[model samples]
Target: MNTTHLTLDEKRTLDYLESVKTRLSQLQESIHFFLRSINPETTPGTVAWTELHSKFNVLIAKYLHLTNILNDPRIAFNPRNYTVFPFEPPANDQQVQNLSVLLRTKLFPELEQADEERIKEGTIPGLPALPPSPAPNRAVNPAGVNTPVGTADEKKQWNAYKLKVMMHDELCRKADGIFEQQRDMVHTKVRYESDDGDEEDD
Candidate 1:
């Protein structure tokens, strides 16, 4: 919005930011789906499972592409310089790294668990098989190994968490839409005023 004033590099950075946001929304949807549907009994090779896995793989690739773009020295993309959203600080490098790790280490392993046969085969069309599970001693959570959602309490908690996350995402999207509309209106007003001044001069 009102990006006409931004330089070429800044505009490209903003575009990259938008791409990152869209990819992140997709990643969140995949995570939510896995949380809601994936269990110990989830059948592999099914349409839903296959499609989600493929989509997840695509999301991962797109995320990596975005990361590389941002990391390019020529781009020098700094999120802090462009404040698209009010009050929310741009994500720092640590936050981006944490997200990358969560997707790779946590989410990828969970996906592999859903289809052990495919994983064992070392490849699945769009997705690659993950390595063997880490040694128990080296696990991120040694005290609590990863397991499918089983207990009624666990299911309830997951559902609650998902609901909260979805609600927050919805609110943020709505706010962004409103902000965009306002920015567009302001831009249009400025353009009209400029036109009127030119007409007066003529």
Candidate 2:
């Protein structure tokens, strides 16, 4: 018997949800294209599988985030400006898992075939093996030194904060420049109109 209304905040939240959904759709399409390019009739293998797996996880996180936002008390009862039903969570489930297996068994061979074709056509150089990722080293405290156990983490956090501050300052500077440019443009237009009026009066 009771109807709920969306506040401006709720509407904004719904808009964000829609945007996330759109982004997920774009990502899915891109992965589909990648799969097709690797093998016309099958899915992609190891390297592509891992990459797609990571993407799927990201999408699932976004889906969960949006779902949580929708379920929040402030937003849940409200009649959303956008529909939030029929959850389209990112495709990291059984379907993608099966695809990965198929890629390994069938699509990888197809990818190898395509790679051979590319090599024959001189379009691509032979696939070079990738270098291994560097392992992170733990910082050790010197004997008799009174350094805290978390000092390394603290230092990393400080560095991150410093970088964030620098980026923010740079962005603000760019925004100021843009604002000045727009202001100058408006002023120029006003001066031009004044000159035109003076000419007409003369």
Each candidate's TM vs. the true structure? 0.30, 0.28
How much is 191 displaced in model 1, in angstroms? 45
- Global lDDT of each candidate: 0.50, 0.45
Query: What lDDT tens digits, residue by residue, belong to model 2 across residues 3-122?
Result: 258777767755765665576556555555555445633443435667667766766676676567555776434323211111112235464344222222223446555543453353
In model 1, what is the error at residue 199, expressed in angstroms? 65
In model 2, the Cα lDDT at residue 188 comes to: 90
In model 1, the runs with Cα more than 4 Å from the true position are 39-59, 80-202
Worst 10 residues of 1 by lDDT: 81-90
| Per-residue C-alpha lDDT of model 1 across residues 152-201, encoded as one tens digit per residue | 65445444433433444454566568557767976896699678878979
- Candidate 1: lDDT of 99? 26
lDDT of 2: 0.45
Give candidate 2's error at residue 60 in angstroms. Answer: 32
